[model samples]
Target chain A: MHDRRSFLKLGAGAAVGGIAAALPSAVSATECASNIKWDETRDVIVVGSGFAGLSSALNAKRQGLGSILVLEKMQVIGGNSAINGGWLAIPKNPIQLAQGINDDSPEELVKDQIISGRGMQNTDMLRQIANRALDAYQLCIDTGVKFREGFNQQVGGHNKARAIRTLHGVGGDITTKLYEAGKKEGVEYRLQHYVEDFIMDGQEIVGLKVRQNYRFPDLKTGKTIYIKANKAVILAHGGFSRNLVLRELVDPALDKTLDCTNALGATGEVTLTAMAHGAFPVHMSFIQTGHWGSPDEGGFGWSNALLSIGFHKGISVNVLDGKRFMNERADRKTCSDAIMKNRHPDGSPAYPVVFFNHDDHIGAEEVTRAVRDQIAWKVDSLEQLAKQFNIPLAPLKQTVAEYNKQVPQRIDPLFGRMMDTAVELKPPFIVSRIWPKVHYCMGGLKTDLGARVLHSQTLAPMKNLYAVGEATGGTHGGTRLSSTACLECLTMGIIVAETIKSDMQA
Target chain B: MMKTLLLTLVVATLFTGAANAGDLVKMKGSTQGRSNHEFIYQDGCKGCHQGSGKQNATDAACVECHGEITSIPVDESKLAIPEAHPHKSLHYNQGASCLACHGEHEKKAPVCAECHRTWFKEM
Candidate 1:
């Protein structure tokens, strides 16, 4: 590894430093731990309780790790995993093999990912995930996560239909299943325990200092405790899509008005902590924001079903002129950019794009939920719907007429939308006006293919420190394809576990 | 200036045990809860708090103790209502802030009750 570089220069904010640097002002900031007692000791400690964290802890326990600890900052265990849309993009998956679907390979998945990432991603990292897609998928099986069989859907950024999902649709089910599995395997969890500092023995990572019984945003409320790790320390705490200060350090354009799709604890404090101990922070500003989030709801509230259904099958119109300005079936980034680019003359979100579809075109339950949640607008006539949203009636009628005229040709000449049938927009239109919200941070700490956090310039591993999940960057370079994180998380989880196990055995 | 100063990972971490809490190391507040956690509210309180108003118990405090209300539930998951009812909650998981919706001494009302009183039988 090369000499260490400072954190990403995303914006003009304070470079969020490490745990050792975090405390001197707040409490005791001394690295003079030689005189200090080793109050507690453990074989391995994994931070954050998301998919990465649980998988790390599980792998450690399975590999004869007798003394392993999992730490969570929030009152709850699961981070965004419990709330995410349970979609995973995997190549050459068992379900596909069972269905006799050939023409899939690690090379193909890597190609699609690099294409989506614009070649800025870690090809080696992407290659590993694609290659071990089955091994990682097997981890889900060993943990007893029952994925929905015979159910596969294509999303933005993939050249193939290799996505799979759990039968228990909500991320909560996976979180609960992993939590239970970990518990059953004797994996213990300590809630409200936030890791604040890394205890170092010269250049090596020994363990970490923590704040016990911590509450979110209540900075000065918890008590400090230090522990030692004899084997290694792994970070799987996820990203900081919600940590505006740290995010602003990388992405200066982040204003207060934008919303986040993460849980309250998705704020990135761990990345800074890892960096403090000689890890390189990369792609700090490359945050992933999507156009489907509704301003009407907060958190990652469940309108995703409508957004997915409506974005493809529906026509989005400018609220002012009632015209379709973007391809309804464009990729996620394009769809979001089109909505953000076309604005009103007054500099506000002009023509607040409205996605509308006939009743027969979308899922009834999803539509009903959207309507009940007050996110979707329901109306019987095109004129009535335009009136309901204050849209110009004449242009809407013309747009619909033109859309129906183009439907029979089985082609979207305007937007190049890929569809089997160009279904005509009929009466009783269900519409939802959507906008962009911060979803995931594609950039994070830099790491190697083995999931070891590395020194950016030197390109050397930080000895015993491993970073995984969204916390480690280089998997998705420019833009992440939908359903890819699930595969990435599981794959890295296995790699880190196996690497540590072999190292320990040696 | 940053190059001159040594960088240590700002994040903090502590581990007693995860799957096995092997030999758990207790921190300063590990044994404690929110604000004077030693004085069990269930034991009725010390003095001034027993009467009412701002000095009394809160919904946030209640959820702090009974954080796993969803798994156990209030109506169905409750082992015994008289005590568990005080710990029962219906809206904590749906992004409703525990402090925002459940206030006790300030007002004996749940904020979710304003819009969703009809939704929950407990309300």
Candidate 2:
């Protein structure tokens, strides 16, 4: 690997002759003065105050990094982690410590993660995350974030009730707790500043050129500031779930289709920035898909009403000409792809609708009051409902009759419905209009076990560059397990911080 | 009789001039709607616009100057609001404002489906 000091010298030369040189002399003088504001140069500079960045900072501090600086882009700290349902799936965690749930070994966790990855996961990275997961889970508890006990249940792949969920609701609560802890520990947080690009010393990254927003009495302006680092720079800037260009570049099929619950700033610019700096991107085709809902009057897609109804274990069918096309019991991704494939004979995109009976609706309503409040349109007769939705009445009637006649039980023989609930037998049947939409991006900048971003060509560490959270790739492998995204952010954040601390000590 | 006629003419001229000037001021005031005025006044819009409050006093007064405004009705039963996608929970309580997420100058609602097609289909 290239030496870090030589890299800084080369960067200084490039800065002098490049864009920094073209600026008006007055502006250049300000930047020079800003660079001198480094109170203490630490071994690592963590970029982002979200879960990953905070975790890295805390770990680095624990590991004895001389000083650490956390730079955040938003006005607040906690990134996306602050906005999520804080469920960290640590198979055997403190709840197990408190309630005596059976212990789960790292090997078993790794095996499950591998299976969930469906053959495309990076084994090395998955192994590292699984091995260190328990420790990370305990770290949150020790730091005063409370977790709910005994409600652990299986979702999607894992066999055990290993999901260690935060009592703080989801992401927001956990992030708040972490933020308070970080503050108490004296982690310097710089908010409302965006890291634009890395300062390169030849092939090694030495620091970052950040743009700070200046709010004046009559004007709002952004001024570029430089931050120099002595150890490493960790990127925790989240994913490209909202970036259409990046999504299209990763998978053309997913272009113009994905729906993200992510914040408006959840663009994959940081990943692109890393790629530009010679970091290789991996698994760009792995897009996560699941149920999503749209407003009836129409504008944007909202949360999946199905999940809101606690129908996670049920089957879903894509009906065309009043018949099922794919297996309802199929996994989320498979079901989404099947629904997208359902088209009319004329090759036009078919409006495949999802059907659930009264029982399913009730179950959903019970789980979430919001779902109950939204059940406004319902009808007893299929013919009348068909007219309302503009579907052919005769075809819909015939399809429901055929479906009702064939099965001895409520379980749809053609498509396996998980719970075997009865069909719409009573009055007031419900149907939701659904079409395949883009959901999540599983591809990003490739990082190693320690969450350090690597040089694309050399496979060596870029002197002061690190990546964590969704911006970094490797943990998900081919496909991601549900709820693991939040877990990865917490676990990897800690790992990167510890690594930076150890590096500084060495 | 000539003096009386002259007095009438003078009164008429002054009234006509005042009416013409008032029309211009009313037009400027109506350009800002009630919500806009409230936002401006509450958010220190007067700090820059100077005398906007006196010009557009009430919501109706603001609408009068701005012309007719169409509002998307909140269908309490729908999971997602029909066209506006107003965060129903937040909006129903009047706890939030349109200007909070959408800037005050926006004349059209954001095309959420252009990027989020799964959630939005051209109706």
Candidate 3:
């Protein structure tokens, strides 16, 4: 731990500038005028131990800067990234190209993002993601984020088939590896430390006031410690999904009805700390929901594999009339939005019941696995499934007949989805009714191509401050595609790391 | 929020230990609110913690009294909606230190409320 007073005195002694010594005694120390002394000092302080934070720390350490600290508020290291479904949506990547699905480029990826956001996403940020998509993916591989072989799976909302998941199929694998990579590069970590506010030196952010040895949610109970950052403070602490009041301020629909899919520590205060320091925020209202959890599960359960199974191998129907509704093949946001827009015949929000009859199109292994995992609700027949879901029996039977007929012909005139000729009926239906859960926040603090947090009004880089991953917005505007959240983390991680390296050295 | 706010008030007053248990030892409040948290708190916190001026209750402490733990559903097994893991998510099973849903300082998280549909309801 380095004393800010002593450090200031040292700086004053070393530099010709007299203000370094004068400001401590005469003027305020931070934006909030915090009088707390410094507890520790580092070249850079990375918030949140998830992929983005760890990536930044690793990059900073690789640049040969000693004294890099990764502070995580959570008891565990990873934030939502640990619990996230481990799929990186990279455009024009070698995996997709080698898998013979490379018609889509960075341009297409950006276009999809813009279209998904309803054209609200920043073009420059999206273009950067598109152009350097592969570079980011490779960086993750270099950091030991191992993707399973032959597992370049395509997820929803993406126009082309381009995504690779971790071998464990969870963000834990990626986050753990990133943490290890940081450790390998001699990056230090301070877990269970909550950042209370940003320390400002003149107009530039120079340090942070943190709550050391902090309990998870009880905010008022921790030791106040200040840490100075010599070069910069990267706000990679993630988004505000967990903060209900803050979330509702932007999207009023995010009232208690919507459950945040992020970790508990993802409250907006970290971003608010930046905001308090004049770092402008953008798209705080444009939140994104995953829209694929069971009305039975309280939050996002372990169901990424199950969701893929449901979307790819099953047909989704509205519980209202037992009829096929929205294009189930659409991206997660599109499916979730359609569900949110519809009402049940009884005035309840229409629940999407995804049913897969043992048409044998889906392998027995997956069916058995889903059943064993208890994610798949298996019933004796379609009648039982309809009864379980409270859907009309006759209409559901008719809808399945129509869908099965169309599946063989490889044409869905209603939705234009190409269901290949692999689905063949056998017996015994397995089903699960799912709805949307508030998954990700598409809008956040605005940033530029260099991954620096920019002023909301002027859009200029906030000096000595940067944000990456879900903390900074613009990569996603109105919405984000499936498997893209992790991709954004990696892409922004590399960009910010390199930028910080060059800028600090320069 | 009203329920969680009230519950948070209860939790802040529930534990009378030290402010924080330092950087390494993860801290959790004693269970005293609605749902099964009261009983869980007794079993996990009461036996060993016993007002020891500490704040470290864990899943390991949970399994000590309850035997092998897999799920933490608010409702019965038959009544709860279905999921791949439901209450027994791998993140929790694989030793996620504290339950994101189980907050001693607050009501069980809203993730549980999303399906149960009575998140802030006073029970």
Candidate 4:
């Protein structure tokens, strides 16, 4: 039996200090001995029942692997993916082709992703995801998922209008459809089964030490049980945005004070557990704050979609000076950076207000609901809007007037924003205060193009260990563009299943 | 005087029984609809708290009394958005946890309200 100190010293590297240090002290003593009694075994085991996890299971089943199991630590099935805005950016998709938009190509999409990612993305991975994007989108449709009728949307940072949303406009729609499809295919799901540690044999991964009937935020609740996997253990556990300790370690600026948009179960324990078992970490410092988050709401609120619309149709102004700060159409990272930098005198976040004219063709239903719920306000005049948020009325009017004048020419002279789709400002504006919130982690276990997790020291692929989605980093570099997360998760999930099947045959 | 003394004794015994029912330690709020209800052997604390506070209230236990989540009647009139019944949510479907919104001993705010509206106080 190896002691806890010796095992951690041997298994972990200096690169994993942030993850290792952030592990709860109570669970630090729980170590997985190499030869543990197995309570159960399966052909394949998938951790975290989000888009990536469910997609991997379905693909594995389709590839003729039997006895697949999907484990979700949360009481609910979908992680953040369920509640996410179900927009998937795919270049040259059917919707785009049908709409006669022929300018888009996978290369063009990759170029935009690279730009949004600040050139720090893995080009190979980005190209791979971009290439298979259409196929991934088709897979969702085949699995009974339906996109919104009429037209596709161009999310921020995308050069083309390539993103398609689900009919219900929430990732839950896609997740529910996929889950139902997987269930019909005999893919087993177990909720509240938390994967705590990986079972290893020599340098290869073997199985998992999981806690069954686990309760959230209660480490001492569930009893420990070991489960064996004959084929592979795929990790699609999303990110650690909700894990304050890990977030603080990587970027001190992103501490507990900032509310996150992730589900409560997105604590990143599986990633930390994998790191404790020699998986290499990548891009740990690149955390993203959503620029559309509202201070009045919690989690991913309705204001998120409205604010996205505001970026195209309106402007975000500073409450103190009533001046436009940055390009509203800029990528999430750029917008968040601008908002954070435009702070109050006390160093608090600026929490700027985004407003668009009520009659500007923005979705009326959403605006009405937001106004009714008090998530957004619909003021009769510009003066009332200024007084509501405490902005100087003169500069507010001047800023809107300048925007209206510049936008008529189809270009923003001050901020370099393209105003081709924008319209002139009108009365009866709808407004919501916007602030940045910890939204996603663009970092996790490092993997090869095959989605096989690499070892920290040897830099070799850890046999029988695979990762996909936000659980594995280097896909989106420094900042992830909106609507691309779904694409990456679906693409990498299929790639992982194929890799595992081929490896097993060999 | 004798009648008053007997009534007080009975009230004290009932309160003590409810407090000592199971792991009521630090459990807050009323069980709403089931307040002041008597607990028998078949459906006491062990009914929902299967392992007794070690695990969350089981969905199966909830189903045993309330019925399958899909079939459970939802009063649309009680909902903020009539279409978004928390139990039969299009997103969660039947997988929504009863404990996520409802608390037995403690007042638990619905997780749905984190993104939506605060409609039901006891949910």
Among all candidates shown, the one with the greatest lDDT: 4
Candidate 3, residues A21-83, lDDT tens digits: the string is: 112222133234355556778988998877788777887777766688988877666777877
TM-scores for every candidate against the unseen true structure = 0.75, 0.70, 0.69, 0.81
Off by over 4 Å in 1: A1-29, A35-39, A153-155, A252-255, A299-304, A320-324, A341-359, A381-426, A456-458, B1-123
TM-score of chain A of 4: 0.82
DockQ, cand. 3: 0.11
The best-first sequence of candidates by DockQ reads: 4, 3, 1, 2
Report, for every candidate in turn, its global Cα lDDT versus the true structure. Answer: 0.67, 0.57, 0.67, 0.79
Question: Which portions of model 2 show Cα errors greater than 4 Å?
Answer: A1-44, A61-67, A74-77, A97-100, A190-192, A214-221, A291-323, A342-351, A359-377, A409-425, B1-123
Q: Please report, as a residue range, the 10-residue window in candidate 1 chain A with the lowest summed lDDT.
A: A1-10
Residues A1-506 of candidate 2 have per-residue lDDT tens digits of 12334333443443321112111222222333234443345557787766777787877777777577887655445655655556667767656545666766666667788887778787887777777887777778767777776656556677666776666445655666666677678776765566656666656777766655421110122445567787788888877666666676667766354445554445665676677668888887676655453323222223354433323332233345555565555566666677677567776656555444544456454323333334224556666666766666666766667666644455556656553544434345555555555545677778777776888899887766788878877667777776677677778887887777656667
Model 3 CA deviation exceeding 4 Å by range: A1-34, A89-119, A153-162, A297-338, A341-352, A359-366, A386-427, A456-459, B1-123
Interface RMSD of each: 7.3, 10.4, 6.4, 2.0
Candidate 1 TM-score over all chains jointly: 0.75
Considering summed lDDT, which 10 consecutive residues are worst modelled in model 4 chain A? A13-22
Displacement of the residue A484 alpha carbon in candidate 3, Å:
3.8
Which docking class does model 1 fall in?
Answer: incorrect
Q: Please give the range of 10 consecutive residues that has the lowest summed lDDT in model 2 chain A.
A: A17-26
lDDT tens digits by residue: candidate 1, A306-346: 87777666778878777787877676668777776656776
lDDT for A71 in candidate 2 is 76
